[model samples]
Target: MDIKQLQADIAAAVRGNDVLKCEVQNALDALSCATPKLKYLEIHVLKKDENINQFTNDLQECMKELGVLKGILPKVF
Candidate 1:
């Protein structure tokens, strides 16, 4: 190939590489921005799960107490 043609090819390749580098950098920045939000969402979900578990336990206790009260009291109907 002629020297001019070779230089043109090298310049095109360098531009392509720069474009790819920018794309990669943009993807990394997006992930960096999303990571903290993801962590916060995870922590919020865990807290809600804990609250649900506590509510379930409390409901179970109430059911047991109701059962005991039913045994102690007579039906009116």
Candidate 2:
């Protein structure tokens, strides 16, 4: 899965509907749904990204994880 696509899809999903003066409301809901997972992911990513040989594998794993996270996300946003 493309990380950029994931990001864009999330944006699209949340903005699925728009309310006057509340354009950010859906984004807020997306953040509420994703922030905790992002925090959890960032910790592991921080540690693994530092290792030269670990970058590729770690990234692939992260993508899989992110896919799962995304699956359950934005839907509620």
- Among the numbered candidates, top lDDT falls to 1
Instruction: Tell me the tens digit of each residue's lDDT in model 1 across 1-77.
Output: 99999999999999999999999999999999999999999999999999999999999999999999998787644
Error of 1 at 57 (Å): 0.3
- For each candidate, the alpha-carbon lDDT, in order, equals 0.98, 0.83
lDDT of 2 by residue, 1-77 (tens): 89999999988876774453376877788889999999999998887766855877789999999999999898878
Highest TM-score, which number? 1
Q: What TM-score would you give candidate 2 relative to the actual structure?
A: 0.32
Error of 2 at 24 (Å): 2.6
Clashing pairs in 1: none
For model 2, where is the 10-residue window of minimal lDDT? 14-23
Q: Against the true structure, what is each candidate's TM-score?
A: 0.92, 0.32
Count the clashes in each prediction. Answer: 0, 0
